[model samples]
Target: MAHRYNLNVFCLPSELVDTLTPRALVGQPPPREPSPPPPTVAPLASAKGCNICLGATFADVDEQRVHFRTDWHRYNVKIRLSGGNAITESAFAQLVGGLEDSLSGSASSDDEISDESDAVNTLLSKINYTSLSDVPEDGTLKAPLTALTWFHSPPSTQIGVYRMLFPLDTPPSAYLSELKAMQATVEGGRKWAMFLVAGGHFAGAIVRVGRISDEQDEVVQTRKRKPPKSKPETEVLEHKTFHRYTTRKKQGGSQSINDNAKGAAISAGAMLRRYGEQALRDDIRNLLRDWAEDIHECERIFIRASVSNRRIFLDYEGCVISKGDGRLRTFPFPTRRPTQAELARCLQELVRAKVSHLTEEALRAQDEAYLASLPKPKPLPAQPALESVEKPKPPRLTKEEEIVREKWNRLLDMVSKGRLEPLKAFWEREGQDLGGIDALIPEWTGDRRASILQVAAQAGHDAVVQWLLFDLHADPTTPVPLAWTKDGGMESDASDAEAPPAGSRRTAYDLARSRAVRDVFRRCAADHPDWWDWFGIAHVPSALSKEKEEERDDKKKQRRKGLREKMREREAREREQERSSEVVFPVEEPPKAKKEPPSGPQKLGGSSGSTDGIAGLTPEMRAKVERERRARAAEARLR
Candidate 1:
């Protein structure tokens, strides 16, 4: 026997089977290679905890990446970076100081340093500085310090100094009390004042707040006094600031505080000496900074000092501290306090800047100067009045033209009514003498511009159309009027057809074809064909006629079939009713009529001389009589 193998029982070696099997099926897969532990991610350099997006921390690169993707974190980041968010008072000061230090440090070029020094020297030269001891204590310095004229003055004229006495030993609390008292005093009079202190200097701005009455107020008051009205009279008093005082600095010294005084003022002096000069300066600067921060004024004065050769140089610069970023920016020109002489210069500059400063004398002088510069007016030349002339009138139409117009109007009426005979008669008389059939009639002067042929075609007057085209030999190619062409010819119902040219003229043949006048124009290439050529007729016959006929036949056949079906249904219903009635009535036939012997033989009329009696009667009657006679004869024979 030959060696045999079982096909179904074929097997592989154990190792081969193991290699072919999936890892999940073959015990636990080789213990996984321990996954290498995820690589550590380091934190970004600028990463910080997000205070705005609560619970968001960016301690590492991965955390920062995740946080940046959040909408809340992104929004806050944008607002902060854009400088739209308000900063704290301390942050504002720090930011401004840091910017200034950066600017100063970055000025490494010689040109930049020289420009800054020159600017400072020029500014210092314009200021008239006075010792603080020279200022009087009776509020005499207040006028110059708070004068609006100084604000309007030129930068040069505004630069001046006056001495003011500040008791240095006065505690910050005392200063606060004095400010409160001043505010109370002003508030009682419906006035407002803002006190700002910065860099150890104090500045105050005052404005009188009150209401003004309009004409309506007087009317309302009178009405209230006269009667008690249903509706309360409303008096609208407009609140306004009648006067404003923008303060200027009056002190001109590095030490803003006074160290020597008598009696109670002695306490302030002793306190200053005890604190030491540097310590005292630091404390005063801190106090002023705090006051400025609290007041939050748009305009304020800042006093800063520079030391050279152990001597102090004090200056006052106007500062604008925006509430948003708390950034403090100084005015370009720094000025010292104003002196008596400087006050006069400030007033002069102020007058130049305002129109209200124009006094009556100044106005008179300006008027005189204007008059001198102007050209002298000359007297008008005398002239005599002239009479009016009449304008020429247009000439009217002659009697002949009027008659022609009447005849043309009659022709138009005939054309509109499709009266071919009347139109022909009219044309024969005046119409032919005037012009050709296509010639426009002067009386027919409207937008239609349609010739007689076009009107006939539109009215579907086939006879008139034929007469105008073939009989009269009128130009069938004459274009239709604009109005008709815009409507794609009066005969055309196809709204989507191409519009006629701007002149909107179309030939008579086109109009006829559009109107579907089949009799006048045969269904040929020249008429309306599927295809045509310049030489002659390209196609012999049109498929339109054949298609239409076939369609008609199909419709007729369908109608006949529908009628036959309806007839058959009606007959079936009638037969069913008859069967039911027969079953219910059970009708019996009437007694058969007696077959009486025919009453004698019927006489027949002669046919002229011949005796053909059967010829006189119809075949049916003769056959009936003959049958009766034969039956009688048969009966007799039977008897």
Candidate 2:
């Protein structure tokens, strides 16, 4: 029979062998052992500090820049010259360039790189780069981070140009080549991971190189830890390695100088341009809301003209977004942008509505003219500036008391008749030397002008509330009480509900009516009073009478007192009964009982028979009885 042998042979690419399988052999060797490859010097260019730091560090051949060296990463990189000389930037770059070119075949010079050119360098100047000793021994990094440095450059600018090196068992190419090969194998690797810098630059390629251990997989898979008695489901992993790689575009992602400027300008312009339509609409809605709020204080007409370029603009729907009540409202526009004809029609409708104030025949004629002119309205011309004239001096008050009066009058006038357009300007133009409302209206504190009140109510401005209530000392009941009125026969706004108890008056009807605040009216009545007049009166139940209300309160107090009294009585009765029924063992007989006891010796019967008669019958009997008694007494004494 012929001799039989089993053998296995395998061959892999140099890059694969460089990382996965060391040059050393395993198992049996061939009869002709291959000579050991020449010893190669580990490149200083490839050496990094500790292999634990997790950061994106690169090494670029063209830039001759290598980040994450043993010194730079672990300690610090200092350029030193021989004989106590200081090295220039050019010299330092030259040395770095020479080292880089020696390790990798690339054209680079010391003069090519500079701190000025590197944005990361600029940022790094502001931070203190932590030394290697500060870094934790384990790979995990703690936060918040103290500082970070990358070629002293910002990634948003001249970033991604430099590359980094980290010390590891395998050569850097082993990692790079493997990633490239995998990409070629899988869909040509079209997509890569990209990094975004604060300055806006993009760069780098990320790679996954290896799998986590089976032990790590178990730990990571568990939802929670097991009990101490039970077997552990997983083991802690010492290291995590990547198994895939990705490349990202390294340059040209940050904004240009001109682009930044243009963006800022556009943002500012939007603030002004967008307000044109909004301002007109807001002015109109404000008027309506104010009118609703101040109907009691004489109703006043409000009108505002919007000058655009110079022509008057119209606003169709200017509903309020925020009310003094802190409510928010939004108007729905057409789902799609409106057509020109639609916009024109809307404008014409507004014009017709306002023109009603004119005479009927005149209105008709005006309407025809307006309709005809609608197709082409004349544009407004810019106002001409008159020659500058000497400004007049403001009035001076001799008395401080008069000063307050003047201020009060001014605030009243502003609220009642001042145009909204000039209101803000007037406030600034006065060169007023007052602080807050004190400067505005020191004395007109009795009541806020209807105009201001209307504005406050419409705008839901609570500061106005303090000014009116506290500063003006406007009594709630002066005109219409601030409290809701729920008298004996009163009905709530919602008549279906019962009236408040005879004296439980606390509603805000007029305020609600003037402000058109519907919700407030309903709520205030429901909790404070029971009746409302908002709905027509139906026979609603009347609230309790004042006496009845008081009785209810008194009853509540009485019930609590009764409970306390009952508890006290129960405790006292228990103590008294225990004392009265307690069993008492007699230590000594009572005097009355002791005196009568000698007569009860006869026949031992109910202590009723005559003991003297029995004693006379026989001495022998007595002797026997005495002997028996002596014997019993002896026995008792012994026991």
Candidate 3:
């Protein structure tokens, strides 16, 4: 739907969807509607009546001015600022103070108006509400960044909403007839509900029939309110899957096709959308259960869900509503993602009394403006007339004819700098139209009319090279004007370089920029050695076939493994030495020398001759014995 805020908002509901729809008006006389004032009544004649008060009109400017000054207008202004529709004057009159106090009350700010607000608050409290879920902390209008809520409906798929109008011209019978057309009746006061579910967003509530009438014409619009402040920051949830990212590992390839990668996005997106669908279903079921009693009170249920998601809300296990329920109906127009605001808009567009201000002239002008705004259709391309008298061949578009200008650059760029799957898929699906896979797939684009295979090989796209040579049986020896000099692997991007000199041709083998790409060409040659004239194409046949290449790769891998092991061993040794040097301990001193006792040892001989452990005395033994004897004597004396 239109992403902008609606401006011609003649009526704004306090809630996205009401708790009740209007009671059907079967056999009831239409409510009296306001008619145009006589031309002589200048004050009222020019006025279309007060928009704030849904069913109110002013007799004159003085009355309108008086109404503007009342507390009711101030109360509605607060409500509108809070993102709610204004209540009717009659509804306001039901307040405890009634219309008397309401009209008598003066405009006040903030806290000063508490008493007046209390009355309106009490009236609101009477309307029981069951919120399906908490309002997102960030406004729901902003799409959530999480994969859980990533299923944004494609652009231009939904109908846009611009304005809402309330008319006094519709009759009671007309409302009843409309209800009848919807297979709903005037049986319950809980008229109809709007249930919407998409992308984990669910909004469902009963909306009652509401009509405009003449009453207090004093319903003045709320003005001068400051708009809500914008948040300084918004949260961005990171993707839970890596499949959606572009590795940019490929050389030249179709990015659009590569980015999608067929089954990858379809499955990933479907998974996310499926989760949201189930979540939405549960939310709808929860709200329906919350309003089970309310649904019994409802006359009809308006649902906006796609075919796949419809059953989730309408016919899931133990669901209150069924797909075939007579009360069930779908929106006539396209709808946006299921949110409370969208649900409210649907009701406003569906059943609210609307007045079209556009006359035939205005409509005509609108049509002309619309036509003027549209992009003009392009003229058909001219085809050459056949001069041959031979029977005209069935008119078939030439396979050699270039693709549409819109897609030409995309294809060129994609092949040059995209993933492999897209290039393979593009050829698989549109190969015939794109002139099928050729060994020398020439792209006569811009100043660089080089072969696509040459671009792929030069860009280090081994996967694309493999697919082309193996699956398409493309000859690696097929040559084209080279973008590089004879340096081969040292060449710069071909797309940026000037065109080669006349007849400077090279095969994809010559342009191979990486070992992986060369390996692919080698494997292709090994598989189909006789497929192309290698000599004419300037391709030097490899001495090693695919098996020999693999053997060489194996030996290189083993050498790399040995080098990595040695490096790791050296690092470990360095770390160990560092740890040992970081620690220190105290050193011990050598023992002091003990002096020999008297060399002539008579006492020592007497003690030594008596066979204690000391037998023959070396000079050292006699000194030790003497010292022990002296120590014992000292110990005996001390004791």
Candidate 4:
């Protein structure tokens, strides 16, 4: 799939490619046709807040003005000046009424004062800490100038945002102005080099603009022009080369030779790739030298190449373009393999900026609409009268059920304590019908609501985990319940009701926390290759059977032993030759598969018509002669 070019996007159609990217704490774009605004709801009117009382909001300016004149406000001011929190209007009234003095004796004054201070402290703390997280006035969120302005979802990630960097400090108008100036350089016919090198295919060209649009736009950059109709000067210089075909992946799919590469072809292809890399580097270097004049006149150099492939143009052997070249810029989105036509497309794409903008309210609306489009979560299932709705406990337990629960609890404890012996004994005593093991099925626990398999795994009990997996037939695919928030939702950006949860949510396999436990799981999974959903657990299970691996190891050992013996024999031969004054002999190679003709056949030099010697030959002799002829014929075909 093509990489998303506009990630903070709501919807960035081709028509809106010029839509101005939003910047935080910056002025809005100049007025355009505004979409229908969200339902009007004026935010609460806030003033500097009463300085003495620390009041936050009021009905209007009139009420705020009246608030300062109130006796309680003045009294609160005095209380603040005395190095303590101000009293509330109600508290001030109670103190002024002298109710404390009437109820108690002279000792009441100190008690009343202490109570007022305590009440004021409690009121001020709430006001001081409380602020709407979504409102810009609170300094948490930046207010959007237009309802359609948007912030990147993952505030830190800015993978495909346009030329403007994330956390952009400049306004859109100024950014567009800069872009306009750059576009003017193109319109004025300055040369720009575009390069796309990937998967052994390299296409690059220094070119001049053909068609230019005067209107600086929201998204649309330029209209497509027919290649034949366009002038030849559009591409001042061009170079393309294709060499490496070592991979099984579609051409230009990737630069790496992974397992998908054919084993038989890999040795030869590796050589080709090594040559291709150097050839590509040499070609680029020569091309740059040849096009020095054109390169010097180049306004900007646009390159689109993978990290490994790009170095030929930038770093290798004193590249023409320095790594820190100001003109250096990468294609901000995915591109097809380097080609003349693709280079043309890249030229058009460079001028366009694609991003959709929306305010927080707009985002909320979209999220709500998206949620509303989904099927609702099913309500909880009905339970017996003995079960509690809030806690969802098990039904009234019979003696057998009570015994089972006790045994289950004991098994849990045994797993936690690494008492696998007792755990196995208990399993046997309880009978081998482990289908009802709570962790194996969807049933977490009767009362504890815990996944016993997860408990075993996280305890670093590989033996226990294996026993549960193999002996008890526990399913590693079964999902464990995750901790939920108070709102009955998971703490994630998106939630899937159809499944338990999504994104980082895992099954029993994940609970294999330690290396030992994880290795145990891997080994068991390898053993029973097709027993579970291995992909869901992110494990590419190896064959549980190790026969192939063992065979390979044995062959390697035998080859090593043979080589060592041969080396020792050679050393002894060399030593004997040094001590003895005898002539040195040539080392003999091992005998080949083909056998030499018998001396009898070579000596019998006769014509085809000389059948007299063969006439008296016995059937066994004739058969032997025929076999020798056949072997020679077969050996000739091999040659």
The C-alpha stretches of model 4 lying farther than 4 A from their native spots are 1-135, 138-173, 179-188, 210-266, 352-639
User: Which ten contiguous residues of candidate 3 have the minimum total lDDT?
Assistant: 233-242
Please, what are the lDDT tens digits per residue for candidate 2 over residues 1-639?
A: 111121000112233223331111112122233223323334357643222222223345422234332222211222111111122334334433423122221232344333243322321222222222222323222222211111111111110000111112434335344332322312111111111111211111112112222454456558557522422211111111111111112532222222444562254434443343345334434443553322222111111111221121122344322212111111112211223333333222221111012233443464455444433322222111111212355666579858756755575555445344444454465525444332222223554222333333333434443343334432222122222232322324544656554324432223322332333333333444533342223111333445655787899999999999999999999999988975432222112332545655544445433344334646766565556556777887999
How far off is residue 491 in model 2, in Å?
33
Q: Write the per-residue lDDT of candidate 4 for residues 4-62, one digit (tens) a residue.
A: 55221212332233433434432322232322322333445453355455343467788
How does candidate 3 score on lDDT?
0.50
- Candidate 1 lDDT by residue in tens digits, 1-639: 111121100111222222221111111122223223223334356755555444344667777656554433433344344332323324333333322122333223446445544322221222211112222222122112222111111111111111111123443324323222322222112222222233333333322222222445557878787643332111211111111121113643223233222232345544453344445334433443554533343222322223320121122232223323222222223434323233223222221222123333454465455544545433222111101222355557899977877777787678767798878877888766667777764634552645776666666777776676556755444555444663443445535566755433454444553434434433333433432231122112232355665786799999999999999999999999987864222222224454556787755763232224445767776666566656777887999
Instruction: Report RMSD (Å) for each prediction in the order shown.
Output: 46.7, 37.9, 27.2, 22.4
Supply every candidate's count of residue pairs whose N, Cα or C atoms clash at under 3 angstroms: 8, 32, 21, 9
Q: List residue ranges in candidate 2 displaced over 4 A.
A: 1-531, 534-546, 588-639
For model 3, state the Cα shift of residue 336 in Å: 11
Q: In model 1, which regions exceed 4 Å deviation?
A: 1-395, 441-444, 485-639
lDDT for model 1: 0.39
- Between which residue pairs do clashes occur in model 4? 17-219, 18-218, 18-219, 19-218, 148-358, 149-358, 150-358, 526-544, 527-544
lDDT of 4 at 28: 21
Give the top-scoring candidate (lDDT).
4
Indicate the residue-level lDDT of 33 in model 1.
Answer: 31
What would the TM-score be for candidate 4 when compared with the true structure?
A: 0.31
Tell me the tens digit of each residue's lDDT in model 3 across 1-639: 223233212232323112113321122233333333322322345553555555456777877776675657755655554444566655555453422122234444457555544545543333211110112222122111221100111221111221111112444324323332332222322245667754344566665543222121223213324543322111111101111221223342222333456543445645554454445556556667877766766555677765655766665677888767766666766788656567666766654332223333454465455545545433222111111212445545555443554345555677788567777666666667655556234344542424667777777888877777777776555555545454543346766777755435676777776788887776666667687654345374663486797888899999999999999999999999998865222222223454577676544342222344444557676666666667777887999
